[model samples]
Each structure stands twice: as structure tokens, then as C-alpha cells.
Target: MEIGEDYRDAVLPQSRWEKRKFVRCDFTEADLRGLVTQGCTFEECDFTRTDLGESKHDSTAFRSCVFDRTVLAEITWTGCSLLGSSFVDCRLRKIKVRETDFTLVSLGRADLRQCELSGLRFREANLVEANLSGARLRDTDLRAARLLGTDLSETDLRGAKLDADALVQAKFTGARVDLDTAIAFAAAHGLIISS
Candidate 1:
């Protein structure tokens, strides 16, 4: 479908979209729960309050899109590129992101509780005030990311690559990390980790 030429509201929910391109489209209040998309591209699209929960995406690319108050919980994304996308006040609970690159994405104030984000690349992403409680971040890259006021409580950071500066700038109360990471964090703060 050629829905990228102009701005329009896409109300297609629970639809199967494959290899389609959507540019500058608005999906406000659209019911997209359980929608399946493969090899689709979304550029500069708006997804305000759109229900995309339980959606399945494979090899999809979302660039410079804005997602506000969107229901993206339990969504499964594989081989997706979310470069430069912004998510505000969106539900991301239980979302499975496999081999996805979120470079330069802004997830500020997004709820990512219990999400499996293992081995995902979040380089230069803005995560200010985002909730990541109980999320699995094993081997995730957080290089040069903004994390002020972000919640990492009960979140696993084993094998996660986060610089000392990034760790210091973020809130880590009750966050679970490996002993090596804990010692590194303590050492960065000039505190001695005792055996």
C-alpha cells in the first residue's frame, strides 16, 4: 500500500501488513492489537494511543517515529531497526526484542517492565525517567545513553555494557547486577567492595 505519500489516519487493526511502507502517517487511537507486519517500514509516523500490544513484527524498520501513550506491551519484534524513534509514556511490558537496534531512540518516560531486551543495542538512546523494573538487559549496550531519573530496580544487568558515567547518572536502587558489575560501580564511586 502507498500510504506514505500523504498524512492520513491508519485505522487498520489486526491486519497483516507485509513489505509495506508508511511515511508520515498518523495512527492515533487505532486498534492494532495482534497485528502482524513483516519487512515493513515506518518513517516519521505518529502512534498516539495506538493499541499495538501483542503485535508481531519481523524485519521491520521504524525511523524517526513518535509513539505517545501507545500500547506496545507484549509485542514481539525480531530483526527490527528502531533508529531515532521516540516513545513517550508508552507501555512496553513483556515486549520481546530480538536482534533489534534502537540506536538514537528516545524512550523517555516509557514503561519497560519485565521486557526481555537482551543483546539489544541502545547506543545514544534517551531513557530519562523510563521504568525498567524487572527487565532483563543481559548483554545490552547502553553506550552514551541518557538515563537520568530512570528506574532500574530489580532489573538484571548481567553482561550489560554500561559505562561508569552512565551508571552514575541513572538511578539503580535495588538493581540486580553481577558481582563484577557491582564492584565496578562501587569502585567508580570510590567505595571499597569487601569480600
Candidate 2:
């Protein structure tokens, strides 16, 4: 267990950590590229300006963590839980996620364009103004997620589980959706769909 430790500007690349717990740790400006962690828990940790590119995590929990200006490109997460985490201005290009839970997480104004986010859970997440253009969200769960001003342009929302309120709140210009979703959107906007 590492609590309240300051690892700012530290270089720890390609490290393997398993079943470790980090609480309130500061990883500002650190280089942790290609790191692998499994079943690890990070609570209230700050990852400001940290480069975590190509990191692989499985079954890890990042509760209430802050990722400000963090480089998370090419990261792979499987069965991980990011509950209550907040991402601000982070670099998330080419990130891969599988069965990850993002419940209550905040991703306001984050750019996740063209990312493959299929089958992930975003229940009650705050995604206001987030850019999800061209992302693949097939079979994803987004129930109760805040979509105010969220860009779903050219994004695929087929088979996604979301409420009618979410459809009416998000921007869906040029988005691909199934017939059920389209009908729901129309109903949410008070449009009479006969046929």
C-alpha cells in the first residue's frame, strides 16, 4: 500500500504491478509508459500530465482518481472499474476498453474520437460536451449518462442501451442508430411517428 506518496517527475516505464493499492498518490509529470497492472486499486490519486501510454490494466479499480492532461494513448483496460474518476484534457487516442465500468465518472469536454468503446458501461457518467465523433459504441450501456451538448456525430450507437432523454439531449448529426433508437429519439422530441 502506497498512501499519499509524491511520485512526480518519476520515470517508471514497463513496470508490472499486481494487487497493489495506491491511495492519494501524486503521479504528476511522471513517465509510466507500458506499465502493466492487474487487480490494483488507486483511490483519490492524481495523474496530472503523466504519460501512461500503452499501459495494460485488468480488473483494476481507479476510484475518484483525477487525470488532468494525462497521456493515455494506446492504453488497454479489461474488466476495470473507473467509478467517480474525472478526466480533463487527457490524450486518449487509440485506447482500448473491454467491459470497463465508468459509473459516475466525469469526462466533460474529453476527445474520444474514433475510439472503439463497444460493450462498455457508462451509467450515470457526466459526459457533457464530450466529443465522441466516429466512435463505435455498439452494445454499450449509457443509461442516465449526461449527454448535454455531447457530440455523437458520425458515431455508431446501434444496440446501445440508453434512455429517451439521453437521445434528445445529445447531438446526433450524421450518427448511425438502429430503428428503435431513432423512434425513441423522435418520441422524446414529441414527434408523432405513424407507421
Best by TM-score: 2
- Model 1: per-residue lDDT, tens digit, 1-195? 555453335566689989999988878787888999999999888888889999999999999998898898889999999999998888787788899999999998878877889899999999988888888899899988888888888888998888787778777877878877888788878897676
Alpha-carbon shift of residue 126 in model 2 (angstroms): 1.1
C-alpha positional error of residue 158 in candidate 1 after TM-score superposition, expressed in Å? 1.0
Q: Using lDDT, give the best candidate's number.
A: 2
What is the TM-score (0 to 1) of candidate 2? 0.96
- CA RMSD of each candidate after superposition: 2.4, 1.1
Number of backbone-clashing residue pairs for each candidate, in the order shown = 0, 0
Candidate 1 structure, TM-score to reference: 0.88
Tell me each candidate's TM-score: 0.88, 0.96
Extract clashing residue pairs from model 1.
none
lDDT of model number 1? 0.86
